[model samples]
Target: MNATSGAPVNAPAELHDRPIGDLIRDARNLSAAEVEKVLSYQREHGVRFGEAAITLGLASPDDVLNALAQQFHYPLANAERRLASPELVTLLQPFSVQAEAIRAVRSQVTMRLGQGEAARQALAVISPASGDGKTYFAANLAVSLAQLGGRTLIIDADLRGPRQHEVFKVSNSAGLSTLLSGRAENQLIQTVEGVSGLFVLPCGPIPPNPLELIERPAFALLIRELSTKFDHVVIDTAAASLGADACVVAARCGAALVLTRKNENKISALQDLVASLAGSSAQLLGAVVNEF
Candidate 1:
C-alpha cells in the first residue's frame, strides 16, 4: 500500500509525482511508519506535510526542509565546500531558506525600479558597518540575478577591504582600479568561473588612496560602460561608516541596498549611515535584515 495515499503505489509514477509524504519517505529521513503517522496528522488537522512532520517531532526543521526541497526539485548546496556566507544559498542551494530570502530581496529591489529598465542598471550594496554582511549580500544578490538569465556583473568597489575577488575565486590582478588608472582597458572584466551570465570586476591592487581613486571621472565612465554591457550590475561598497567610499559609489550607481544584521548591528550606527546616504543621488531601494 502507498504510505501517503493508502493505495497500491506505482514506483515509476510515484518517483515522478508523489505527494510530499511519499517524497519525504523516499529521502529515507523518516521510516514508512513515521511517514504514515505524519500523513495521518496532516489529513486530520489539514496542516502542511513539513509542518506536520515538525509538529509531531518526527523530523528536525532542516530535515523536513530538505525533504520539501527534494519534492520541489530544487538542489541543495554541497555542505563540504568552504563557500562564503551567501554563496552557497545563491549558487548551489536555490531551494533553501537563505536563497529564498535573497530572492525576496531581489523582488523588492526590482519592484522599486521596475524590471528590464535602464533605471535598474546598477545597485550599490552598503551597510552601516563592516560586520553587517554587505559583501555577502551583494555577491549572493548578483548570483540570484544571474540565475534569472540576466547578464549580471558584480563590482568589488570596496577597495579598502575587497572580497568579491576571493568570493568568486578569481584573480584580482587587474580590475576596476587598473581600469581607472588606464593600466587596463575592457579586457579586465572576467566571467565568473562556474556561474553562467555572471561576471566579476574585482578591485585590482589595493591603492594607497582608495577614496581618491573613486573620485576620478573614469570611475563614472566605468559604471556607464558596465551599465550598457550587463543586464544588471551590483557594486559591493565599503561600510558606510568606515569612509566616504560607499556614498561616493552609491551616488554614481543611482541606487543602493542597505544591509543590517540582527543583534549584532547598532541602530544608532544605521541611522547615521542612512543620514549620510541622504545626501547622495542614489535612491534607497530597501533595507535587508540578514540573520546569518
Candidate 2:
C-alpha cells in the first residue's frame, strides 16, 4: 500500500551525456542483456527514447517535453508532436554498410585536406562512367554525414541524366537548373523532409549543353554559395570518362571520390580518369570499389 513502491519508474536527468548503454540500464531498470534489446530497437526504428530522455535531462515524458520547449524554442505540445512523429523516428536508423563505406571516404578526404582546409566546404562523388554507382554512393554518403550531425547538401550535378531524386524517391520538379535559370532558387533547393540536416538540389530538366552550364563562372559561384550553408556539400557528378561535366565539377570540389566497378573495363576506365585529372589541381581523394 506504499505510494512510492507502486509509482512508475522514471528516467534520470543528464541522460544524453551518459553512455547509451548506461542510460538504457538506468531508465528501464533492466539487465545488460535486456538493455541491449532496447538499444537494438532504437537503432532499427531511429527512436532513441532513453537517449531523448537523457538529451532533454528529464525523468518523465512531460519533463522531457517541457525541457525541449524551453531550450529549443519549441512549444511543449508541438515538441511532443515532433518527437512522436514517424519521420523523426525514421531518422534514427543505424548506419548501413554503404554508409560506412561513404564515411571511410569522407575521413580520407578530410585527412588529405587537413582539418580546416579539407573540411572547409564541399565534397563530391563521381565515377569514370555511368553504372559505377556514383549517385547511389553519394546519396548514402550524404545520409551518413547527416547521421554524424553535419548539415549536408547533396547536389545532383548529373545534368545529362539526373537520378538522385529517383534514388531518394523525392521530387524533381524544381532544382538546380531551375535555380540557375533564375526561376526559383528558393523553391529549387529542396529540404529533404524527415531527414534532419540533409538538403538536396536535384538536377531539374536536362539541358542540351550540360558542359556549358557547368563551366560558367556562375556555376563556380553557386558552388561557393552552397558550401557556406552546409558543413558538407556532396555533388553527384557525371562520369568523367563520359564527358567534361564531371571534370568541371571536380575542379571546384575540395576532393572527389572515384568509383570503380569490379569489371575490367570499369577499373581501367577509372585509372584513365585518374590519369586525366592528375594534371589538374583537383585531388582524387581515393577510389571506392563498387560491387566488390
Candidate 3:
C-alpha cells in the first residue's frame, strides 16, 4: 500500500485516499458477506484486508492483488489469468514496492535521456556479466515509462540470449535479427496486449553473427527510426564482459545504463565494461545496483 506514493497525479482524488477495504469492495472481487468476514478477521488479527482475504480463503492471492490493483488504478498482468512475477512486477503489479523502485529508475532515465539539444531517445540496458539482471530492469523500466502515457518500446537486442519476447509474452519468430537481416518487415514490432503505449521487439532467431548484424549501419537506422516513432526506446543487450554486442548496441543507441547484481558481479569486470562503453561513444547514465 505504501507504493501508492508513486500513483500518477492525474488519478482520481478518491482513488488516492480511499481505504484499502473500500477499494476491495468496489472491485467486487468479494461478496459483501465475504468482505465482512475479511474485515472481522483483519480486526482480530491486525492483518491487511488483502492478507485477511487470502488467509481466510475468500480470495486467492492473485485475486486479492488484482483487487488492490483495480483499487489503485494500476494495470493488471494479463487477461489470461497469468500472475506477474517479481521480475516483471511493473507491468502486472504497478502498485507494488518493486514497481515503485522501477518507477524511480524511470524518472532518472527520463531526465537523463531527455537532456541536451538532441535528446538521447534510445537507451541500451547492459551489464558487465551474464545474470546481472539487465533484461529484467530494462523490461520493467519500459513498462514504467509506458504507464506515463507515452509511447514506449523495448527491444530485445541481445541476439544470442533473448528474453524480452518471453517476458512480454510475444512471439520471437521475427524481430531485431529478422529485421536487420531484411527477412522481416516493420511487422517485427508487437503491441503488448492490455498495456497501452507499450510495444516490444523481440530478438527473433539467434543469428550466427550477432556482432556483424549489430555493427552494420542498418542497426543505427533501425534505432533512429524507432526513436522517431516512440517516445522512449529501451534496448536490452548482451553482457559487455561476455561479448562486444552490448557495446555495439549501446554505441548505436547513444545512451547506456549498466546493471549489476549486488554481491554477484565482479567489480573489475564492471570497471572494464564501463571503460569500454565510454570508448564506444555511449554516454553512461550511471550504474544501477539491482538487488534481484
> Per-candidate TM vs. native?
0.71, 0.67, 0.76
Clashes of each: 0, 3, 0
lDDT tens digits by residue: candidate 2, 193-266:
54556788899888777888888888889988877767778899988766988877888775777788777344
Choose 1 or 2, whichever is better by lDDT: 1
Could you tell me which 10 consecutive residues in candidate 1 have the lowest summed lDDT? 1-10
Which structure is stronger by TM-score: 1 or 2?
A: 1
**Which regions of candidate 2 fall more than 4 Å away from where they truly are?**
1-96
Candidate 2's TM-score reads 0.67
Q: lDDT per prediction?
A: 0.78, 0.67, 0.81
Clashes in model 1: which pairs? none
lDDT per residue as tens, model 1, 206-273: 88888988999889887878787788899999887779898899888989888899998899988887
Please give the ranking of all candidate structures by lDDT, highest first, separated by commas. 3, 1, 2
Off by over 4 Å in 3: 1-73, 78-81, 84-86, 115-120
Best by TM-score: 3
Query: After superposition on all CA atoms, how large is the RMSD of candidate 1?
Result: 9.3
Residue by residue across 1-292, what tens digits does model 3's lDDT show? 0011266878676653677677666665668788888999999999988888778877667666766665555566854624534467876566778788888988888787675534546999989888888888998898888877768899999988999887877888888899889898657788877666789989999999999999999999989888877778899998886689998998898888889899998899888888886656788988899886
